[model samples]
Target: MTSAAERPLLFLDVDGPLIPFGTSSGHRHAAASDSSASLDQGNPLLERLDPGIGPRLMALGCHLVWASTWMDDANEAVAPRIGLPRLPVVEWPDLCADAGPRGLHWKTRHLVEWASRRPFIWVDDEISAMDRIWVAAQHPAPSLLHHVDPTKGLLDDDFSALAGWLRAVAPSRVTSTGD
Candidate 1:
């Protein structure tokens, strides 16, 4: 088994990737109704989370880290709902000061710095071509900036892509167990 330090870091975003904000699909309405009955009353968005995603993510075998604006709140509210243990949260620098070249997402630079050349995967809704180019130029190790569809959230296809990338980057860490 690989040590946590040796594993790739999967930087996860909460709003889009976990708690999808799709209004057209009626997911929000369903979530709202569900949230009213749930214990996490503070944020109804928590209801959209699919508890099954946690296991799917864990099955990817990476060191999961919260990289969303929710920050520590994700650990407090999101983790328990989804059956995930509290993972490390990425601390953001001043968003204004850390902004990189135009078109780059504010979280891009800090995430790269946090990875510190270790292989990593960033799963978010906002990743763009500029972010990909910048990371390619700056980071030395292999990385995947997976853009999750905010409408659908983390689906099987997304999981497949993440798992495939992990297998390519660190084959030893990926097991053959089925999802």
Candidate 2:
């Protein structure tokens, strides 16, 4: 059973899911909508924030976390301006020992430390096939991983998908902000 205070964790990825094509034709049809920024020269994807969705996510009992390559700097810099709730940043291990060259064990490492024992949703533009496979391994009570594409940028599909998944996993979908 889940406690009332704990929100369902949402591991938000910065680049692909957050910043996408900015109403431009260049990347309009691109699947990921990734490109370099015209002004900042930083990845344009970093500039795309899903409007009015961050707070809703928080309200829906999601403890959002920064789980991107930018977890250290880039993502953090952009999150505040975008209204994403401050997050507990988690990092991946150095290498994938057992999985070998193409093992994609970073997901596995994160699973063990973070999501393996908790319920989580991964919002990334880069969740590969290996990621899904690894998630499947942890069934039952381990975790419920929801992959949200940044290109969609918090579209109804994203929220409904998340809400449904969360409803099933985190029965107590209300988080208390009692500090």
Candidate 3:
């Protein structure tokens, strides 16, 4: 049996993977001023979330961590709507923490350190070659930086790839049920 500590971390990003920007047919960006106001009235984008995603994610058997700009707001505003419990939130460092190579994502460095050599899956819309290279060089354990399309959110193929990688890295930590 795998211990809790043996479970790989699933660092989930909310905006792109959970709450899609808009339909695949079109993309929409809320004005800067409307951002905070929209959160107060209820983010219209949240409606785009597929409530079924939570179960599919949980079924993957990784330890889910909220790795979004939404922070605690993911637990407060997003969790209940999607049927997920309050997950551990990844506390982001200050803005200046981003001092990596040119194209490396701001979150990549922190996430690698947070994982602490444990295997992890970083699901975000912003993953790039730099991030992948950095994680490959820095993190000792296997890692997957799965990129989600903000316009489409997480698709069936995205989930399949994530599950596949998890199974490959930690076969004992996950049980395949033909999902």
Candidate 4:
């Protein structure tokens, strides 16, 4: 098995992949009612998070990092609810008028920089074709820019895709089904 340091990094986002926004009101209500005691009561969006996701993510055996606008807030607010331990947060550069090529996501460049040529996976809702093309050219190592549907969040199929890619890139490191 590959050591943790050599394992691929899994850059995770919050707003879409974890807390799905397009869920039905009834589902939202049920989630809110079933909220964990440790969860922050003020942010209703936190309720949408499935506590089961953390283990599924951890099972992938990648180094998880927070790559969301939530930043440290993802550690403070979302981690506990989902059973994830404190993870490294990607510090974003201040947004300037010229972030990147037109149609490229603002976070795309930074995530690549943070990966520092290591194989990595970026799970976000905002990835575009331009971002994929740019990363392909700039990042020498294997990378997957998987876009999560904000409406559905990280569904079973998403996990399957992530696992499949990880297995192809680093077979021994992918330890479980991530189901």
Please name the candidate that would achieve the greatest lDDT relative to the true structure.
Answer: 4
lDDT of 2 by residue, 91-147 (tens): 766643465336454654565458646666777666677666667665334354555
Each prediction's TM-score versus the true structure:
0.87, 0.71, 0.89, 0.88
* CA lDDT of every candidate: 0.83, 0.59, 0.83, 0.86
Better of 2 and 4 by TM-score: 4
Tens-place lDDT per residue, model 4, 5-62, is 5889999998779988686753433332244343555777787789999999999989
Q: Taking the tens digit of each residue's C-alpha lDDT, what string does model 1 give over 1-179? A: 23435799999998778978786656544432344344455666676789888877888888999998777877878899888999999998986694979999999999999999899999999999999999999998889999998888988888888888887778777763245
Check candidate 4 and list the clashing pairs: none
Q: What is candidate 1's TM-score against the reference?
A: 0.87
Instruction: State in Å the error of residue 130, model 3.
Output: 0.4
| Clash totals for all candidate models | 0, 4, 0, 0
* lDDT of model 1, residue 75: 84
Number of backbone clashes in candidate 1: 0
Task: State the TM-score for model 4.
Answer: 0.88
Candidate 3 — which residues are off by over 4 angstroms? Answer: 1-5, 31-40, 176-178
